[model samples]
Target chain A: MDCTIVKIGGSIIDSPEQLQRFLQDFASISGAKILVHGGGVMASRLQKALGQQPVMVDGRRVTDEQALKAVVMVYAGWCGKNIVAGLQSLGCSAIGVSGADADLIRAVRRAPVPVDYGYVGDITPESINTDFLTLLLRAGITPVFCAVTHDGCGQLLNTNADTVASCLAAALAQTGHISLTYCFEKDGVLYDKDDDSSVIPEISSGMYRSLRSEGRIAAGMIPKLDNAFAALRNGVSEITVTHARSLLSGKGTKIIL
Target chain B: MDCTIVKIGGSIIDSPEQLQRFLQDFASISGAKILVHGGGVMASRLQKALGQQPVMVDGRRVTDEQALKAVVMVYAGWCGKNIVAGLQSLGCSAIGVSGADADLIRAVRRAPVPVDYGYVGDITPESINTDFLTLLLRAGITPVFCAVTHDGCGQLLNTNADTVASCLAAALAQTGHISLTYCFEKDGVLYDKDDDSSVIPEISSGMYRSLRSEGRIAAGMIPKLDNAFAALRNGVSEITVTHARSLLSGKGTKIIL
Candidate 1:
């Protein structure tokens, strides 16, 4: 049951060289199933280029009708295929997926009552069917997931990559392989982004709340940590957060109970 | 009252030079609202390269979970943006859209009754909102649409470009605009493919029906004719089927009731 879910963040995807190297490394890992989660950095860049300043409320991009379409074009088309091509060039079979496919990732539209963030959504766990993932893995195909989900009402919405990665990890956790998240900028679970030396090698569930109270882990890292802890508590065997290059070098922070 | 829905077929889009010429001509037209429809020739080619044979039932391609993602990557990512870039070079503000955004084109997933077709679907016209198009046109923005629709139930399905163009034409008919479908191969609507001189200058509903009965329209042309008539019946004042270069030259079969 050697199956691992790896999330490739959008920040790293911006560099073609980095992506190519990652694909080369990814192909060498044999006997393991993989799932990918991508972000909308490229799409977001497009919005800025088009003079539509992105409005973000509580970590979610405010996806008005126009922004939603732009993101869809960039995420599903640009980012997804480039990765698939990378994997293909390495002779690995890779399949790109969005939540709309087979209702792969059903989401509840977060109607930002306080802010009016038009089309952003949240993942609804009950809607995910891991059996599809099982089938893909059994077929020895790598499923590359994009950070987009359907509200189950015909409309597709942009979702957070961390949450997507978490859901996929939890979905495949029963197979004994751990969840690994790769980001470009950060070292392994730093106690403070400003201080690299404060990096924590490992943290238990008990320390997370205090760390947050002390405001140690914040920004995008907070939700990622929260999702990781939730997955671990929900029966996921293990989870790790780290830099892409460090993953193979055993230099990441492992989350524990 | 001067809006026009212009459809650029997949064949023209298959060649970069042809596509560039179309974009240049598209920029020359003024005082009319333009809507673009693109095909999935490149995406379909990539799909075959990936070893996932397209599953088609009836004449429509079934977008399975994997293929749906592939199309998004190919259509919106590669083809849509590239087209928009070309149009932009000619000073047109082009926007790319898929069925998932704002429920642009809702669909109902047909049961996989056609044995080889895995996940094909049909459109739900009532779900398309022309408000976005109206807004873009009012702002002098050209809206480029891809032939994909959401099934209102969290599924993205492959639809025919002709159908999408017809629907858009019908949706925009209130403004008394014409719909023009551009193919790259021939100068005009040919009565017979073998003899270019057998070009049909005009086609009425009855003539089109007789052509169909005589088996003159086969395979791909069947949908084009069906959609052309469907647009006229629904509300479009006029519809033209011809070469993209002839769009401005008025060298095509004009279909009217």
Candidate 2:
């Protein structure tokens, strides 16, 4: 993959020292790149501080207007800006962007179904403005994206980070060969759920299904893995699941079809 | 100015109805444009909401670590993102940015003299990335900037809105015929301080000095005009001081050499 789109999970963002170390490694990767990041843990904490208990329905946190604002503040404001600044300090030029920026990504508000997700956005790869993003990338600016999108009619919508990464890798595949990575606290897709060092070196889609049948993979990992596989199908060259610290060395699980 | 750089002061931002009107008019103006905005009032209020009383000395707010975070959250997160979204609603494509984004503007932290204004940044026209800005503008993306800058070494600093506007207008003058506008609650620099309709239609630099000597201008207007005059002298073709409602019709005080 000539250009990498890395999705750094919320766990990496919880510790400042760890986050700085991760950025130091992320900046060392050579090529035009993009960063899409998660905000759940931080957003939840900030929401509590602002006197609102986060509302969770069916194991998913519902995004109300207040919650949306809180998350936008944390992801786009704290994480996105500081990550770009950290990259700058490391001699890698980066720019922070929300989906509303330059109309880079336009999403449709999710329709209320079995439950109302409330201000959640759903995006397709076709909705992304690859032409404008290519201009930014060719100019040598690494676009650091937050988990916020716009409805084109001017409303901010909360989006899942993994989905953002998947859509971007698919949309921007033509810019260069695309490598999509999901970095979190774990080493990779683990062979033993309880052991941090039990990294499974490789997992094909059929293997992923068998592991799911055996109930080995965590429930939360399913959607993320689904996103990774979708990205691969849509033309991302490869998918890597690793802890942020090991990104530069390429030590992690590689997903295959 | 072929490209207009407009600074919306905190006074105008204080009122939601007024801000919306201003943005509508700002979006209606034809040609490339950039928006610089002030945030001390909103940031202070948010800081107070978060249980931190703002520290103020001699008309200036001290930007301690907490205050800096407060301002960044308010300006870059809430204000900047929403402004771009608001402009999008008006059919203008705008992207929000901090100085750290794309290395658009670099600044140096202010040194302690009589008072340590901790975390405040001072910038010059030379520090702005005119080339990058021109690219964004040429691509028809309006840049909405917050009062946040970076020290290039990973520190984000709080810069004055007027300074951000002045520097941008001066630096971007080469892009086209430049007209810089400062929009606030008041109509313009008023001849009679109590009367909003008593705006001084035109104030030459010599006239500004004479008005200063005569003690007719308000103290706050002095610095804003100083910035306006500086932009005019730095190759910006014109400077307008007006209320947001008068933005397109060009009804306001015009500063001259």
Candidate 3:
């Protein structure tokens, strides 16, 4: 069976109205589907509320012990459960989970050599438990995942949501065709940063190299595109970057090999 | 198959060492089993950190909007995921969940006619989705549940963990024999509030009534025992109140019909 994996960014999740609309579209997706989400904005806000200053390096959170607790609370607890509840209200049977739940994803703590990203975990397709995921998909249940994974030795680790989605897509692709979508605030990869309508319809690896050389692609989007290309190189059938509202509209930039 | 349902109170959850020990014992329980947990102490601490004053009426949290969010973060997020991770480390396949997940347990919002408990939910045996739970149990996955439930209309509500355990036992009893256990700091229902070793081996309905009439039962134990009796009336096979350490020792107060 074909599977669809949709990952929503923190911008969409931070807004209740936007999240509801996105979930409505997500619930309408037919076939086996999964939702992976990031709650960085909320997690940062919670950290501030608790008097901990959030540190970010190169657009990635520098998770300390305190920050890890905040993310676990926000991502797995607040955002994940609320999203599941919203989907359930729309008549979609959704199960909210962290990677630790059923050992769905086991991550190794990142080696703190170059830069110590405390409690951050790095994962690949090998880390996913595809058998259990297949079981859930076969049962007609949509899994809603938060970017909280666990090391097999009983430690919860914070992971990048984009990495989780891409790896999950790659893992699921082993059994069947899988499509991965990255949904955020933008329409797609834009030709002009200031223009909303300047979405580039498609991008090839050659074009991506030139775009990077010309500094046309935003620095922030580099990691996402890298993840996209990696998923493509693995076994993912297709990958797209699009606005959250245009999930089923086929109005996103599709990545090409 | 026989199933065991155990509910741990907030006191045990607030201490890391205590919780780990409890999970180790909980993991060794054979057969299909479930864990229900309460994180009230942690929730209250988070609530205070978030600048919300937790109000309790009759020992039940009067969950306002802020308190609701705090509990959701603490119970379902931090505590639930951590417990699942701990159990997984102990070689137990555990899945952490809130009531909203897969709509495992749907609750009705409490009516305001009785002093308004802002966002509280009440559940019964009929509220449980036994089919899905059975599927998980048969698949050898032990579910770790927190005290957060949701109304079918997409609202998460605070629920008493003891009620969740008893109700789940009653619901699962429809298909098979179920034993419910409530574990806390105390060895069992005590004969005297001041005496730690004065554990009551057993209590019948007659003794319970007389104890309550004589004011011998602790005020807090009343609701838990009430839930136990209700579960017995509703078809649960057996119920026990025991200390967290004596889960498998067969030493505790047994409730008899």
- The alpha-carbon lDDT assigned to residue A48 of candidate 3 equals 98
Give the per-residue Cα lDDT of candidate 1 at B168.
Answer: 79
> Least lDDT summed over 10 consecutive residues: which range in candidate 2 chain B?
B55-64
Task: Estimate how well candidate 1 is docked, as a DockQ score.
Answer: 0.09
In model 3, pairs of residues that clash are: none
RMSD of 1: 15.6
Clashes of each: 1, 4, 0
TM-scores of chain A, one for each prediction: 0.93, 0.96, 0.98
Against the native complex, each candidate's DockQ, computed on alpha carbons, is: 0.09, 0.77, 0.90
- TM-score on alpha carbons, each prediction: 0.56, 0.96, 0.99
- Most accurate candidate by TM-score: 3
Q: Sorted by TM-score, highest first, which candidate order results? A: 3, 2, 1
Best by lDDT: 3
lDDT of 2 by residue, B1-257 (tens): 27888999876777778889889989988889999998778888878878899998755679999888888888898788888888988899999999999898899999988899999998988989988898889889999999899999999888888889999999988667888999887889999898878999999999999989999999778878888888888889889999878888888999999
- lDDT (0-100) at residue B19 of candidate 1? 78
lDDT string for model 1 (B1-257, tens) is 56767888777888878878887887677865565555567667756755678765556666777677667656765566556545645666555566554345666666655453444456534556676556546656676777766554444566677777787777777666665554556766678867777779898889988887887764667777777877788778878878887778788888878
* Per-candidate iRMSD: 14.3, 0.9, 0.5
Minimum summed lDDT over a 10-residue window in model 3 chain A is located at: A189-198
lDDT of 3 at B246: 87
By lDDT, the better pick of 1 and 2 is 2
